[model samples]
Target: MYLGSQEMRTVLERDNGTIQKNLKKLTFYYGASDLWCPVQYYEDIKKDFPSGDIRLCKKGIQHAFVTSLTSSREMAAMIRDWLKDDLAEM
Candidate 1:
């Protein structure tokens, strides 16, 4: 999902408890360098959902996966390989 600045602000608010609770999983494709949410955010989120699954995909760029990835073929191949590991428990 493409989250705009306004939407992110809404999600970060404590009053949006229902929305926050429903977001059990978070996937970040950082492209290896882009620290979008920062390390402290990751640490804080982990503390809240200690056992929740957080998927991170680091590709061939520094925080520019969405823009730098020239071919979807490589991404598809990577995903297929990653899913084979059976990450259902995490």
Candidate 2:
């Protein structure tokens, strides 16, 4: 399957009030060396949306993390942990 080499879509902007209202509830995770998204993209979004939970993978995982069983397991566990608190309150 083709992955990480396509051009990005056009940018979309919403009202500041709407963005701020939903920012805190969103979680954005990017691969440390993802080819699909450059570091600049992460930085830009982080600077624009400081209130959101934006995280970069520090485990050296790449864009195709699903190709590796170990990475898949680690990523899945990390996501589970991230959502554990929310699940508990549900």
Top TM-score model? 2
Off by over 4 Å in 1: 1-11, 14-35, 55-61, 70-75, 87-90
What RMSD value applies to candidate 2?
3.5
lDDT for every model? 0.52, 0.77
Candidate 2's residue-wise lDDT over 38-71, tens digit each? 8877787789888778887788987877999998
Candidate 1, residue 18: lDDT: 52
TM-score, per-candidate, Cα-based:
0.47, 0.72
Clashing pairs in 2: none
Candidate 1 residue pairs in clash (backbone atoms < 3 Å)? 33-63, 34-63
